[model samples]
Target: MWIGSAAVCLDDKNRILMIQGKDLVEWAVPSGGLQENESLEDCCIREVKEETGYDVQIIKNLFIKEGQAEGGIHYQTHYFEVKLIGGDANINDPDGLNI
Candidate 1:
């Protein structure tokens, strides 16, 4: 199973912060699979900073879901509302994804 965590941040105008990256896929909130021993909150914060260069604090868990994709790939994802603490809006994704 793929365990993931995503961060939800809103702009000053209350617009949702979405990212369009190298995948050329649909725009999505900053998210990724968790590393061993990493908490969901930590993973959410790390993914947001890594993908969008924004330091974030996990405010709360907005929702959690699990699903099975084609080819039997299962996923468990957690979404959290986050507060921006610092950092620029520039992208510097460790995975080479552009924001």
Candidate 2:
């Protein structure tokens, strides 16, 4: 099962949160694949922190996207709108992601 999440985080000023794509070299929202032994909510929180260093609270789910790839790998992604609870915003890629 392929499961992942992406967060559409906005600030009080209505500015959207974005990150430079580590692979694609374009601006994109923060997202990541789910890890073992963690809830989906936890994955979202962790991914945001790992990629952008911002702590967040998942307000609610926005949508769910499911599809199949070329090799017939079924993939699912959960999108969420989040609020900033704390933490600074900056790049802190744990996996050394670079464009």
Candidate 3:
């Protein structure tokens, strides 16, 4: 099973913050798989910072989606509403994927 977390942030204009990695054709919220010994919320916050260069605080958990994909891979993703705390809007992904 693959476990992940996603961060949802909205600006004052109600525009959702989205990111597109170099390998992804579609835009998506800042998200990533959970790392060892890390909480889901931490994963969400870290992913947002890594992908978008934004520090955020979790406001609330929006929802969780769990399902099985083709080839029998099961996945669960937790979605959370977050508020920006600091950092500028820029790509600082250590993996060099986000653009």
The segments of candidate 2 whose C-alpha lies over 4 angstroms from its true place after superposition are none
TM-scores vs. true structure, each candidate: 0.89, 0.85, 0.90
Clashing pairs in 2: none
Evaluated at residue 9, the lDDT of candidate 1 is 90
Clashing pairs in 3: none
lDDT (Cα atoms) of all candidates against the true structure: 0.88, 0.86, 0.92
1-99: candidate 2 lDDT, tens digit per residue: 699999998777989988886457578788889999988888999999988889999999999989997889999989999998989867776777762
Ranking by lDDT: 3, 1, 2
Question: Model 1 over residues 1-99: C-alpha lDDT tens digits?
Answer: 999999889978999878896658789888999999999999999998888888998788899989998999999999999989999987776766455
| lDDT top scorer | 3
Off by over 4 Å in 1: 23-25, 97-99
Select the stronger candidate by TM-score from 1 and 2. Answer: 1
Candidate 2 local lDDT, residue 99:
22
Q: Of the candidates numbered 1 and 2, which has the greater lDDT value?
A: 1
Tens digits of lDDT, candidate 3, 10-86: 98999999987687789988899999999999999999998888899999999999999899999999999999999
N/CA/C clash count, model 1: 0
